[model samples]
Target: MKLSKEMRGFQDRIGHQFARPELLVRALTHASISSPTRSDNQRLEFLGDRVLGLVMATALLEDDKSASEGQLAPRFNAMVRKEACADVAREIDLGEVLKLGRSEMMSGGRRKLALLGDAMEAVIAAVYKDAGFEAAQAMILRLWASRINAVEDDARDAKTSLQELVQAKRQKPPAYELVSRTGPDHQPVFTIVVRLDDGAEAQATAGSKRQAEQAAATALLSKLEQKQ
Candidate 1:
């Protein structure tokens, strides 16, 4: 069960040494690169998703003893969401260690948010299987500490909250437009504009369409707040 030099280096970065080196290798393997003897991480990803949920639920309760269920729900979602996992994966450069097919690698799979997120979860499950729940919990908590700390600042997605506010004012739902697109096909930047019928609008550019829309909504929401 000895780890290769490169895998051991990856273990060092993640702060978890695998007892079963094969588990680490399997966890790093992607479905796109599957072989007869090679197993992908989809199963591990499923288990890790549950493990992450349980850990986040426990942490949220412990952090805010007085918060009601309604108050804690969104915080829990934000922490356990794929985006959060992907953020942690990027921190550890998990993508660099992944074993992807030639097509995936050529298409920039290493930089894909979903691929990184799933790999991160798989790694969590690998740690959990190799050691135990407590070890997995410790690793998750350490990697997610900063995000967990900032959970209370804003729980709602800006676009949803802004939609509610506009409806309350008798305005139609905001219109979102694709203003412009820049960057490469593999890693394109999108410019999104969120505009109201009355002409108040804000534009934002981001790596993804959803992110750009959210940023645009957040910017427009802030602009509205300043006027009031």
Candidate 2:
């Protein structure tokens, strides 16, 4: 499985080349792009999820020796969250390099958050399968180093920050409502609305309900701050 000139350049930028280039292609191929009979990244996503968890856990443990599990769990979750994965995909411009079927391409599948996020995970799994754990860990760390700092500094805890802002204003706490949930069982996407007493509302989406709610709260807080 020979890589195209474009893919070779991509591998060079990411600092890793797949031993089995087909695995890299498969990892980039979403189910919407390829039939199950051919190949897709679902299995790779499953494996990547665990690999990602281990990599992030190890990094967190090494960085925060005094942190408790309770404090660490949210930070870990924030790091591996789909939104974070999609952020990395955008940084790498993965959407431009994705190979999609005609229909999926027409439907804007490349820009879809779920597709981008899953493709990122699949790529992680491919790197692990091609090189090994250390290679994958290095790739993930390179992409996620800044995000880990944000998590450690509490910059990623939008919900908590929003609550603090609301309290400072002497207003009642904002409330979150589930506006909608879409996507499959294994990878559900949620849209949530956060409402403040002043009739302001903001909406956001995340891979899970709680994450969506936090995003919504963050958005609401931003709006409030802008008004002030």
Candidate 3:
């Protein structure tokens, strides 16, 4: 239950401390760690997922004075997507604070996108439970303010923006082909490839085809940006 000095400083820097340090401990504990006394972050990840959605939804409502549900839904999804959360977690070095078993540690679980992303959500849930929604909202704001601001611009929809970019060059509309699927039918992981007319392609995976298509589109746009 004891945190290193660096971890303590990290909490301080974020302007919140856990009332029950075990909550924070559990938030950062991956399931790969097997010990009678150790708990995994899965449950915390579940709670945190809801907390993160609610926080982001409330923020979007408050910040977008004229946005309808239709306008805000994509923005919300983009903001709370796993990759986005993982990016924020990495920025704060949350991986360094995680407690992993030797197996997980050796296998690079600390850098695993899914685990890091889930831990970020679990941390958000812990903050909300320990302190309150305001604290959690503040934390999200600190991490997402820039992205939120960019969302206000018309170019926020990466998929649609990418489509336009392709069209402007008189190219065919991009096609998304299913590359692979894994996991149970009820919760399938879809891998999709976005093929452009210029013979360029990008692939991404998500929990659903729609999400996978969006991810693939985003990746294609990123590649286009890099080329320019």
Candidate 4:
């Protein structure tokens, strides 16, 4: 199949030329727009996830030969997590090429973290299928070079750091509570509260629960750190 002008442009952005343009098309097609004749990217997403994991694992081991599994695990997670994929997708404007159904389009599917993350994985799979593992790995490493270089800082997110700080102080792990959720199903906002066993607490609101929890944890951790 021939590639569309827009998709070809996207190819330039990601720096990959698809031998099988159909793979790219399939990767961009969301389930909401799928039909008996047209497949979605779910299968590609599954395969891409494994490919990404392997590449990240190897990269981490190569970068930190002396690091133990305990140290590498979180860095791996930070690099391959859904949010990280979505961030990369946003960087390349992956959402612009997404093939969404009317309902999905109306609901801002292009900007949804889950959708963008899934599509990004599918795109990786497409590149793999179009060429080979080496091609996919090269693309991934090129796009994620900065993130991999800074994996240490990326691994210790606010929430994890907060948990470790409390643990070191002999306090129970911090707890997160969902205070409220509002807005439409597709665009709901979550308010989360993170509390330390010592009664220190902080609340934050965001589009996703994880984000809200992280914000809450950062706030509480900041307060705790100030006292030290």
Candidate No. with top lDDT: 4
lDDT winner, 1 or 4: 4
Q: Any runs in candidate 1 off by more than 4 Å, and if so which?
A: 157-228
Alpha-carbon deviation at 7 in model 4, angstroms? 0.2
What clash pairs does model 1 have? none
In candidate 4, how many clashes are counted?
0
Q: What is candidate 2's TM-score against the reference?
A: 0.68
Among residues 3 or more apart in sequence or in different chains, the pairs in candidate 2 whose N, CA or C atoms overlap within 3 Å are none
Residue 17 miss distance in model 4 (angstroms): 0.8
Instruction: Give per-residue CA lDDT, model 2, range 105-197, as digits (tens).
Output: 999987989889998999999999999999999999998989887784543467787778778878889888888889999989899998877
Provide TM-scores for the models: 0.71, 0.68, 0.67, 0.72
Quickly count the clashes in candidate 1: 0
* Evaluation by lDDT, superior candidate among 1 and 3: 1
Ten residues in sequence with the least summed lDDT for candidate 2 = 64-73
Local lDDT at 31 for model 4: 100
Model 4 agreement with the true structure over 116-162: per-residue lDDT tens digits: 99999999999999999999999999999999999978887677889
Model 1: lDDT of residue 183: 96
Candidate structures ordered by TM-score, highest first: 4, 1, 2, 3
Global CA lDDT computed for model 3? 0.82
- Whose lDDT is higher: candidate 2's or candidate 4's? 4
Mind sharing the TM-score for model 4?
0.72
Winning candidate number (TM-score): 4
- The lDDT, on a scale of 0 to 1, for candidate 1 is 0.88
Backbone clash tally (model 3): 0
